[model samples]
Target: MSDAWQHWAGFMADLAAVLLSLTAAALIPILSVRALRYLTARRNDHQRETLHRIASEAAALAEAAFADGNGPRKLSLAIGYAQEQCAGTGITASADTIRAAIEKAVMDYNAMVKPWSGLPAPGAIAKPKGESYSQ
Candidate 1:
């Protein structure tokens, strides 16, 4: 009876070892993939936020140029300034696309006006020097 019990205990120990090995083999790849996905998502979010900041800077510069009466050169100057700003901050984006988007935003703002506001067509100048809109 003592010898039989010893053999059973050894077998149970071997089984436990095999089960632990299998669990590790199955779990390692799953955990690695999940970690990779989390890192990729974080990188994407950072890139997105950087792009948003660049776009905002571009739009604001274009609006300021317009308000300064830059005429047809407002969008182009804004794009150039935005590209330089992005380069300064190490952000990557297309200058032409940024220019086009700023142009559209300026035009849209110029074309639309609320009826009850009693304000003139402000064009791209959403906030003038003393205007509190931007502040």
Candidate 2:
């Protein structure tokens, strides 16, 4: 009877150990995936911020270039600037991607301004050639 009881106790201990090992093995992949997701989210947030900043700067530069009548040159410079900014921010986007993003930003800005363009101010009146300032 004592021999049978000892065998039963040994079997229970081995079973518990095996269950613990299996549990650990199952948790490993779950934990690894969670960590990878966290890291990827952080990287995405950084890239997003970098892209926003680059788009804004490119728009400003493009506007200046357009105003100066050197649209092509300015657009090229904006692209170069974006590439430099991407490198600085650890973004790996290609030049073409950056250029496209900048162009889209500029186009959106132009479209946004087009609505109120060439209109006079609300309270201002245009003066004729012979109009007198004081009446």
Candidate 3:
């Protein structure tokens, strides 16, 4: 009876060990995949924020450095500066994407600083010049 009990106990221990090993094997890959996904999302977010910052700064610099009516020159300066900055920071952005970002930044800046000059304010009426509000 004693020998039989010992054999049963050994079998149970071996079973538990195998189960633990299997659980760890199953969980490792799942955990690894989740970790990888999380890291990728964080990296992408960081890159996007960095690109936007660079675009905004480049746009402002171009606007300040160039005069009005030099649209093409200003765009060229902003794009070149943004591309150079991106390269210096190890970012890989195409010229079109950089241009789009810079344009967006400039639009946003303009909207903030000169709200009436661009698009009309939301829900505002467009009246002819010299027309009174009460008319």
Candidate 4:
């Protein structure tokens, strides 16, 4: 009985050692790659999420400004904020140009829009800016 118990113990110890070595071998690179992927994905996701939230907020602000009929002043402020965000996102327009661009945006927004109406016109997407409005 004692001999049988010793054999079982030896077998168990060998299995445990093998398992530990296998786990160690598998764990090192797997943990490293998982950590690297998690960090990279987190950074990219954070940047993308921030940009998406900013765009949503800007759109809401512009829509509210338009809805409240706050006139050119509120819209101008909204456009200015949008322009700053665009520049932050690597767009190349300066604030002065962006201001003019905002005016064009406002014109486009004003066109095909009825301040009192509830429906959007066909194919009437709000442009970031419009050159044709000034020309």
Q: Would you list the C-alpha lDDT of every candidate in the order shown?
A: 0.72, 0.83, 0.92, 0.68
Off by over 4 Å in 3: 1-3, 118-135
User: Candidate 4: where is the Cα deviation over 4 Å?
Assistant: 58-135
Among these predictions, the greatest TM-score belongs to 3
Q: 1-135 in candidate 4: lDDT tens per residue?
A: 999999999999999999999999999999999999999889767755554454445545777767766667665666667767876786554556555555555555556474546667756966556644665
In model 2, the worst 10-residue window by lDDT is: 61-70
lDDT (10s digit) by residue, model 3, range 59-130: 999999985759999999999999999999988988888999999999999899988786667669677787
For each candidate, C-alpha RMSD in Å?
11.0, 9.0, 4.8, 12.8
Residue 118 displacement (Å), model 2 = 14
Between candidates 2 and 3, the one scoring higher on lDDT is 3
Ranking by lDDT: 3, 2, 1, 4
lDDT of 2 by residue, 17-42 (tens): 99999999999999999999999999
Pitting candidate 2 against candidate 3, the one with the higher TM-score is 3
Best by lDDT: 3
3 or 4, greater by TM-score: 3
